[model samples]
Target: MIRWDWIGRNLPEIRELLGDHIVMALLPILLGLLIALPLGLASVRWRRLYQPTVGIMNVVYSLPSLAVFIVLIPITGLAEQATVIVPLTFYALAVLIPSVVDGIASVPTHVRQSAVAMGFGPMRRLLQVDLPIAVPVVLAGVRVATVSSISLVSVGALVGRGGLGYLFIDGWQRQFPTPIVVGIVLILLLALAADGLLVVAQRLLTPWARARSSA
Candidate 1:
């Protein structure tokens, strides 16, 4: 049987660090979602914002991870920048931006027509009709972003950050396998747990949409 002592001993420390990592990872994604969602909405709504914003996000996403970290270190400090938001936001784009755009765009034209027929105001229509219908698609993006970010959060630990990556790195450097195994296993469990939760969330929120999507 596999020993559980290392995991037991490290639980508090691991939880604390992972908490920080999750916080760091979440802010950028949330901020990016705030920016990317509106712009993505406008992109499909107005067309003018789509090409340029998409292009920019694509470029940012394309940059190599190490290269982005290297460039960011000077401006944000070696310890903080590489450790948290810079890389977190970069990884968020491919999922967040496109998904927001697609989710908004997927709002059928006839639905808009119905909103207009009912004389619903722009914001009213969006909140009551469009967004509700679009939520499943948006949730799909969040699922992707969250899982990817969880793993990347480990990467953040590389340059003196928090999360399980610290365990992996320190374990490697010290020539011990306990922390390494525990860390890797915990991170994997985190990702799996997150994915499972989202699956439940999607089913709960988009029960009707699931049939439509599957059909």
Candidate 2:
């Protein structure tokens, strides 16, 4: 049985924890994007480096989040947020790099030719033509990264910073199920909300795609 009364009484705390959870899940994503963008672009431009770079990132992603967090504690200290953020960022990078490369590659050959015919340089063609077309694909990766980060942040609670995951731990130790259930539900809602927002943002950013879909 669930306790709505307990949940109602704890609404304020739940709200605060939800905010923390959002930050915990979101900050690493933003940081990872900043890092992934240039690397992804370089992978596309360099051609030969693509597979090797992606392979290395996949190796990093294979590392368990708990292990990464524990490993970072020695360097960043247990209380430092970097212990959690760094691992989540690496995970984000793994998904993003390949998506970016493929997204850019998916650009039509005729589009590239037309850009070159218009006297666009490599940089201009990439920025003006290729990246715009790649937005949907890149965003698809972002949605995955976000949901994964949200789930992984719970593991960070073990190190003292898991946002909603802390609630799960607290509930388990106290023999209470309300907080644990609430935390699970809230995390799911948060992931769905984040994903939905990304979809809306993609439509806004790529009006041409919206128009094409309507047609």
* Model 1 regions lying over 4 Å from their true place: 1-3, 81-83, 210-215
- lDDT digits (tens) for residues 147-187 of candidate 1: 87777777665567756788888888988888887777777
Worst 10 residues of 2 by lDDT: 76-85
- Model 1 / residue 59 / CA error / Å: 1.6
Indicate the residue-level lDDT of 99 in model 1.
88
Candidate 2 Cα lDDT to native? 0.90
List per-candidate RMSD values in Å: 2.6, 1.2
Identify the leading candidate in terms of TM-score.
2
TM-score of each: 0.88, 0.95
Cα deviation at 56, candidate 1, in Å, is: 1.7
Name the regions of candidate 2 deviating beyond 4 angstroms: none
Q: Give the clashing residue pairs of candidate 2, or none.
A: none
Candidate 1 residue pairs that clash: none
Candidate 1: deviation at residue 176, Å? 1.3
